[model samples]
Target: MTGWDISPAGVQSVVSNVRDAADAMNSGITLYGKSVEGAMTSAGTLSFGTDGVGGDAAGLVALALAKFVEGTERDMAFLPLRASNSANGAVEATNAYISGSLEQAWNAQRQATRAPDVTAFLEAARKKAGEGR
Candidate 1:
């Protein structure tokens, strides 16, 4: 009888770390932008709001990240208990697959959340600067 010992806490921790980082980044940018007296013009606002760099796009990305995390957490909620109680090899394989998939999803999400398109940032900044309003 093979035993699976996956920790749901461990999985949650991994996802939590990335989520925290994304939250921090988003908050920091928001804080910095707000701190400026007249840093953002309408063009920049529109760029971020409409273009695929920030604003609504970022919000949607955040929403997607949240849903992914919630779904993963729900899926793994019973995994720790199962790991401790189950003696079935099938459970072990299933746990492994779920954990592996969560890890992959985290990797993709982290990359997407952390890295913004430089071209978009530059264009937004340029437009904001040129608009002068």
Candidate 2:
């Protein structure tokens, strides 16, 4: 027969690591946003002349930078929430594992299979961190 062994302490450790990662990511994102807040506008104003090719080039550059920043922000927005949800799920599974009951095991499996509510987790984290963003 094949079986699995799980340590609650190990799972708890993973949960702590994940939460720490989420917090770090949140801090980094906040810092990055602040640092580049007006970069797009600054870049756009680097035009050389009213009808010069440099103006068009500067506009294109600004647009590209804006898009890049937007994409980066969008891609990173949910990462912290994902990490938090994963940590929460790990804790739930660890509890179920410790209970050693068939029903709890099934519940854990269900929880694992469900999609994480990242938006809610993000909101909670932001609130906990005393951040309006």
Candidate 3:
């Protein structure tokens, strides 16, 4: 009992804080990219799209379980057979890629909508002004 200096609750809190920071780091990068993607992308807090990372991670988990369940050879999707895919790499590239692409697409849509055809606008204005003629 003397050798043990920390409580289980303390260890749990540390784990939670680290997980939150990592998520924030990933999210911040996405925001920075969104800023650059202003014209070619979108900047938003949320979206309606597939989450490749989550899905892929889930796939990874299933893969690991399936491997353990089937006791078969390691597939490329779940690589590093022995110790590579620890399944602890919480966020997967698959979900991130999907989410990122949709964000970009959404931004592109916004840019397109904001663009106005000045010539057409002027023509309409002039036509309306000369309506009597």
Model number with the top lDDT: 2
Error of 2 at 42 (Å): 3.4
The per-model lDDT (C-alpha) reads 0.45, 0.70, 0.40
Rank by TM-score, descending? 2, 1, 3
| lDDT value, candidate 1, whole model | 0.45
Each prediction's total of clashing residue pairs, residues at least 3 apart in sequence or on different chains, is 0, 0, 8
Tens digits of per-residue lDDT for model 2 on 1-133?
0164778888888888888889999899888776675675566655576778655444666678778886675457767756766677767766776777646755765676566675666577679889654
| Residue pairs that clash (backbone atoms under 3 angstroms), model 3 | 41-107, 42-107, 51-95, 52-94, 52-95, 53-94, 53-95, 53-96
How does each model score on TM-score?
0.28, 0.62, 0.26
Model 3 stretches astray by more than 4 angstroms: 1-4, 39-133
Write down the lDDT that model 2 would get: 0.70
Query: Which prediction has more favorable lDDT, 1 or 2?
Result: 2
lDDT of 1 at 60: 43
